[model samples]
Target: MNSPLPPLEAPTQSAMPEAMNPSPDRVYIGFDLGGTKMMAAVFDAEFNILSRRRRKTRGNEGQKAGLERIGETIDLALEEAKVTHDRLAAIGVGCPGPLDLDKGIIFDAPNLGWKNVAIREFLEKRYNSPARIANDVDAGVYGEYSFGAGKGARCVLGVFPGTGIGGGCVYEGKIIRGTKSSCMEIGHVQVLRDGPRCGCGLRGCVEGVASRLAISAAAAAAVYRGQAPKLAALVGTDLKEIRSSALAEAIKEGDTVIEEIIKDACKHIGVAVGAVIHLLSPDVIVLGGGLVEAMPKLFVGEVKDAARKNVMDTYRDTFKVVAAKLGDDATALGAAAWAVASLQPA
Candidate 1:
């Protein structure tokens, strides 16, 4: 199989031609829709962010509010960039899913409190521009493949640990949307049966053990049980204050209890990643999101060791585990790349 293209640098203003005489390929807008926030960016063909805006999703306000938020963010971005609708080629959205990608309808996203929302139609109607929507993680993987760490790799797997765990994959320059779009739900993969219940109602899933939510919950439990001294002090009688970051800090301070918790969390993540490596044999596994950022040494080191130990010898040396290069902007850039790719002849 051919290797993937090299990661493109984020385009700068100088990279975009100053002459704004709307070419056939004009600016593309990318939207990353998350449960709490929505980010919109306008990018030229070279993937330079001309303007970007972010707003709260206000999910409790429901779908109407979310759509309005998305529209408002896009409008703000366009206004900031002084770009008109006529100058836009298309809009690409990276949204939470269990979606009908072909139909552009989001089936359900627990974080967004959305169900069966026609996102593409909403964007097209509001912006009067062609629009496309995809799973946010999928967009992240595509973004990484096009302009981040996964560039030049034959297969790339993106693992993100935020409020929840999520993953996306790219194989041979294409996003791998498996049958029914059920492919790459890495967070839900079971690492240990009967260990702990996840939001998805599964026991011992990766999300249950390795996500930020999980880590925070574990910290709270430890504080409640009087097992973590630093966490208890930081919480100061408020268990809710024992968050993932505080726990990570405690580990950095060499707190034995926090170290044990970190080890356990890393072990679960490692096992889940090991399974993914053995199953997909991706050229690179890119890790990102809040948990990894908070505890880079723990997540990266443990996952790499577990994956190497678990995989067969023939495949052991072929895969590399690395950090996601794009950080938070990955999904947005991916949306822009998706728009660009869609416009090209299939």
Candidate 2:
């Protein structure tokens, strides 16, 4: 059950600034925006990170403060790299959705506490450079496809199971931008009808079942009831300290309770991924994010089996599920790719 939000206004496309010329000597800047932290990097055409900076997002201070921090991070990265704006080819940003890609406007990002903020506009003004905005997962897919594991794949699906379950797809070489940029909201896809409530108020969403938040919540409940011994021992009195890695570690140690929880979560994730395989039949499926990276044996293998079991035999035999190669830098590198692609004339 997807929550209903007010209609978002279309983004206004700004003409590409003349300064965004193709120059091998120029550097590009990329920013990855999150609820708690923001990271910026300066890179050359070859994708070498010349400099990087990070800052607390300060999302509670509202959109203005978040944007300010993002600007500061970009500035600091450029300053550290000793590059002037003239040497910058473009700036790319990867942020949480739902976004209006055409207008470079973000409609609503629950994690960032932003609604209808013109992020690209703000970035362009702040840095005096041509800027482009994309959903974080989409940017990551682009990053991987352009330079990482999914390179040369005809169709690639990137799934990240983090604080929330989010995904993005690249069909052939282009990012799949659905109607109003709503394509690939994989997290909100309903896996169970009338099931667990999601942060977006939806029931039985993929994220509601398989996200780190959901897993952590379940762990907390189990701890409250004294169901998990090893996990409790590892985290002490605070259930909040029991992260996905800790849970994975407990499962690795063969703790029955933690194993069961992980199995349940994996089943949900597998089912959801199975749906993706059935529908898209992508050539490559990249599973990433903190949980998948930490518990590869558990999460990745389980999802592969579940998808193979549930998907059509023809599709199952054709698609390959693998871990993302870029890991945490996917967003940043993808943003750089977006900037390069967007700035180049078609």
Q: Identify the candidate with maximal lDDT.
A: 2
- Clashes counted in candidate 1 amount to 0
Query: Which residue pairs of candidate 1 clash?
Result: none
lDDT of all predictions: 0.80, 0.82
TM value for model 2: 0.90
For residues 36-64, write the lDDT of model 2, one tens digit per residue.
Answer: 88899999868899998988888889998
For candidate 1, the per-residue lDDT at 208 reads: 86
Superposed on all Cα atoms, the candidates' RMSDs to the truth, in angstroms, are: 8.3, 7.5
Model 2 segments more than 4 A misplaced: 1-19, 224-227
